[model samples]
Target: MTNELTDRGQERRDSILDAALTVFVRDGYHATKLTDISREAGCSVGTLYTYFENREELLAAVLQKVQAEIGNASDEPLEEDFNRISYADALRASNRAYLVGYRANAKVMALLEQAAHLDEQIYDHRVARIRRYIDRNRRVIEQLSERGEIYPIDDPFMFTTALSVMISRLAYYTWVEGFFDDSDETLERVAKTIDDIWFRSLGLKTD
Candidate 1:
């Protein structure tokens, strides 16, 4: 009985999140109301509030879910075996995984892109998240520097900040701008762009 009830609760939560994604992506953060989300979720406003504290809280939850999905989709390892991976190969793998993930979560990417224009908090949230991800890969940056694959930068943090902005711009364009035709060509172009930018930035020889 307890297990059945728990499953039902999980189902309801997922239903709310699914509905919220549609509403938030279509109407955006500022314009979407709790009542709107409630109706979409097939629940009453009171029930919606029972699960979320407020609109901001609900938006945070939705963003969290989107981030989690993107993270999972981007989880391709840098190597078949971690100890055997070259720095260049790891960088290429990471870039490829990120583009794949962004494509998979294009809707959330679109919503965030739109929301950032109107909300400073949303913009800052994205910047902070990018910083956090870069920080997690500090060892990779350091390794590249030690091998002289990248220029010796005194500050990895500053290097990552600038590099992240460039990479983020490319991902945004590829995922949101519709600049490339929907084909293998587009994917190949994105991957190559990522590789070229990182290679040039790190002072590596490029093809």
Candidate 2:
């Protein structure tokens, strides 16, 4: 009985997170309140508190939810299957996935940026999560280098970190910048920038 209750409670928590993401994206995080999320989730404020201690925690939960969704389709092993594909192609493929994920969760991404400014802890966690993800894929990057598909770099880990941060900034500007709306053209530009950086950094020509 206790286990069932716990599971149900968790489900409710997840639902609240989904609703919260929508609200945050629609209204921005600072403008959003627990009451707003509760109403959106079809739960009482008290019920919302039963799962999350505060708005900050709720935002974190929402961010985690978005991250999970973004990674859902990224579970395939790195494309070491064939040796013919250029390193630029592999990098482009990975970055295209990122652009898709960002588009899918634009609202959540906006909310996360808003939350990061209001709370130091949240900001730190967001940075750490990004760095960790890059580190996790460092080996795949090195493997591509080994295949001679891409050029080798002095420190692939740091290169990955820099690349991640740069792409994130590109997405932010493209999506949130005033008078500069995000579009397929902008996404392609960002992808090209990434390819250029990777190609040059690895001593590979853009040809």
Candidate 3:
């Protein structure tokens, strides 16, 4: 279905989505209007409607674009050989990947979190997304524990929830907003601090 769009059509749609993201970020979901997105995209309201049926669809498309750009990178299946790497290497690799991904997409992520609070439908979507990640991590943690690589977590789901919140809030505060210094050194320190916390909590050893 996505392949049906001609290049020009797809470009126009993408432009609309980009504009929608800008308005959503600035004015938030409750305050943003479809006309605002159309104006920002330099398209008429009718044209915008041709691309997206409603604001919800447009917002969903915007989030899908972001997930494809930021979240999908690490969602790729790692090779068997990659999984064969040492426990510590795996932990550090995954943690580093998250820090990099979150840093790169902090603004869009913050917007997503903000939307979750304003709308019940969006809140459900957010909860489902987080639940998916938590389930995956719980399985990974179970595998690592079975392999005797780290301390067994009694409640992997809860741990994943906590870890995800910590990272999300940190990314919002440090990168999206200007609460913390987002310099290279500080990002490095922040990532290291997360790793330290993970290691301390999970009883993970050095590489």
Winning candidate number (TM-score): 2
Listed in order, each prediction's TM-score against the native is 0.79, 0.80, 0.79
Report the C-alpha lDDT of model 1 over 3-69, residue by residue, as the tens digit: 3436778788779888999999888777888889899999999877767777766776677788776
Model 3: residues with Cα > 4 Å off, grouped in runs: 1-11, 76-80
Model 1: runs farther than 4 Å from truth? 1-10, 146-151, 203-207
Show how many residue pairs clash in every candidate, following the order shown. Answer: 0, 0, 0
lDDT of 3: 0.74
* Over 4 Å off, model 2: 1-7, 72-88, 204-207
- How much is 104 displaced in model 3, in angstroms? 3.2
Assess each prediction's global lDDT (C-alpha) against the native: 0.74, 0.72, 0.74
Residues 1-207 of candidate 3 have per-residue lDDT tens digits of 244778899998888888998998788777989989989999899997787778887887887787665545544432225456765566566666666777876767787777888767667777766676666566667777887878767777888778767766776688878687778887888778877876787787776
TM-score between model 2 and native: 0.80
Better of 2 and 3 by TM-score: 2
